[model samples]
Target: MRDRLRATLALVVVGLLAAACSTGGGDKGFTGTRLETPYQAADIALTDTSGLPFSLVEDTDKPLTLVFFGYTHCPDFCPLVLNNIAAGINMLDDDESAKVDVVLVTTDPTRDDEKAMRAYLDGYNKSFIGLTGDLDTVIEVGEPLHVYVNDGKKLPSGGYDLGGHSTFTLGLDDSAEAVALWNQETSAKEFAADIRTLLTDD
Candidate 1:
């Protein structure tokens, strides 16, 4: 088990390197430059769960995005994190709000089509975007984000577990570079506050 986990981590790291080098991204238009990304990424293209082309190069022109990785079938963490996003977005000031986006990217592409993703996110806020693509493209996004979703299978009782996942959420600059990352546990209020600071700064 330990060896398997290590191998998985290694694979993620390698994938991240690939992502960092292959993207053709440019700068986001944020006058406030106080926040800097803790990690940098090579601009990459990823389709949202809605099957729309969402490229880092194109979309970063807007406000910062709070990106989270999870699947539709995830019974708990997925929804919980999204709810936090909704709450946080609601808390932003008008000007600050204009500079923030909340997006959900799915790890399970096979089961999470655009319709499925849309339905899942509808429970939270219709404005929240759900992104998914082919398994290969999905990996391209997850690797750079460093998210891992475990295998899912039928349990003895018949209700299959959607596999455990390492929770990953990040705040990104217009350049899609990671400015702040919140792992398994981080407060929504704090995340909201930090985003406001980033949005309002010059």
Candidate 2:
């Protein structure tokens, strides 16, 4: 069953990327063998939209996170992904909902400073935190998560395009650990269900 789920998930990743692969924490409770599954999440570092230091290490005590990377300037996909996440969170039971977090790690640090992030996130989910830091530091953060961004140039037409990048969504457990070999790449509806399961374990 787990193997079949993994296969389904692999295909989902491929499809999202072709469509342009697109697209938390805090302690509550639960001691069930964490990560009793097949996959686990990666650790990373970034700053929240408020410029708050968002070190993954610090969150080891918090519930796991659903991590996604992209820039705010992202034309369409970024917003859709974020809105989808917001929709998922809305489905959670109020109590279980407090155990998880959604993270937006920005690729366009040049423009996505604390003030910018805070403003951008206000439009959608207030629970969401956007993060950015120094270019080198941001690059380092993306490495472990396998997120990439290609050189972008200002177009004569005004806006620019993402030169190179891969969209990915990652989930982590409440112990600040990545859920082992779990299914990702789910829709807002599907994601909400997975989140509910994780919250129950918490």
Candidate 3:
């Protein structure tokens, strides 16, 4: 399963590179990879940590939205990405911060209930929104974004390993169209700089 996930990720990376080239180097000023073709935000209706229906498009009031697909149980990737984003937001001015909304959609909903999701996200940023729902619903939400989500190999203890999921953090504009993506390796400084660029452009 790990091998298959790696292959899929490799293909995704190749595709992103090809798209970047074909698009004549999209939005060169941004630190993240600009999309060749923007993606309209998925019309998602998921339960937030507060047990309220959260509509990705309608609920977000910010001009810029950062959407990430991950689970709370992830040992390294999830925390790293969330923390960096949180730190990046902290670097912005109050007005700039208010223009951005960070959202996390759990890939493993079986264990990531509303309570658990809220607790996990609070450790990073209290303002960060976490969404969880039925596994099928979660998969459907990720499909249009090209963020793959799948269960991992089982362990001898009857538990499973970390789930397979895409690591890109998508950047969405006011129109709810995805404009860019950041990989797991992007630093907090890079995130802040790119966000500032977006805000200025807007």
Candidate 4:
């Protein structure tokens, strides 16, 4: 079992390397960059804050699905990314807002309980969905998305420390195909514009 797990993790690392070097980001006016090879959305199972079984394919209800991976305890990037997303979503009219769904998957499942996840997300947008599960399960879902998650540091106290993660948000079209990616610098208005293009472009 240990060998298998290590092998799987090795493959994930290789995939991340390849993805990082690929020449994607080709769009003209997108706030988020475009990937030359838009990854096919991976359908992994996890539990939502509401205790319901969730999978990417089943949970994505709109034409555009935005997926982010990070922990609630993250003192910087995570909240900033979500806040940007919420702002982007708010920029849309009712019709446009209804066309998108934003999801956050926790990297620090050890400390991020349902209550914490719910409260953190509610501060940004009530409609945003938060997902958490066992460590292995979260890694399985995150790996294909090129989200690197660490178990975190150990504190002098009994509690575990917060970990780090890749701070990019992925955008997927209705076909469940990855279409765009946004880095920490992306603005809400730019994100909204890219989303609109993704929903309409061929």
The candidate that wins on TM-score is 3
lDDT of 4 by residue, 66-87 (tens): 9988777777777787888999
Looking at model 1, residue 94 earns an lDDT score of: 73
Q: Candidate 4 regions off by >4 Å?
A: 1-26, 151-165
Model 3 residue 105 distance off true place after TM-score fit, in angstroms: 0.3
Assess every candidate by TM-score: 0.70, 0.68, 0.85, 0.80
Cα RMSD, model 2: 9.0
What is the Cα-based TM-score of model 3? 0.85
* RMSD, one per candidate, in order: 7.7, 9.0, 3.2, 6.3
lDDT of 1 at 120: 80
Deviation in Å, model 4, residue 159 alpha carbon: 11
Separately for all candidates shown, the number of backbone clashes (residues 3 or more apart, or on different chains) is 6, 18, 0, 2
Predicted structure 4, TM vs. truth: 0.80
Q: In candidate 3, which residue pairs clash? A: none
TM-score of candidate 1 versus the correct structure, residues matched by position: 0.70
Q: How far off is residue 184 in model 3, in Å? A: 0.4
Question: lDDT tens string, model 2, 54-105?
Answer: 7655643546577766667787567777777788888887776677777777
TM-score: which is higher, 3 or 4?
3
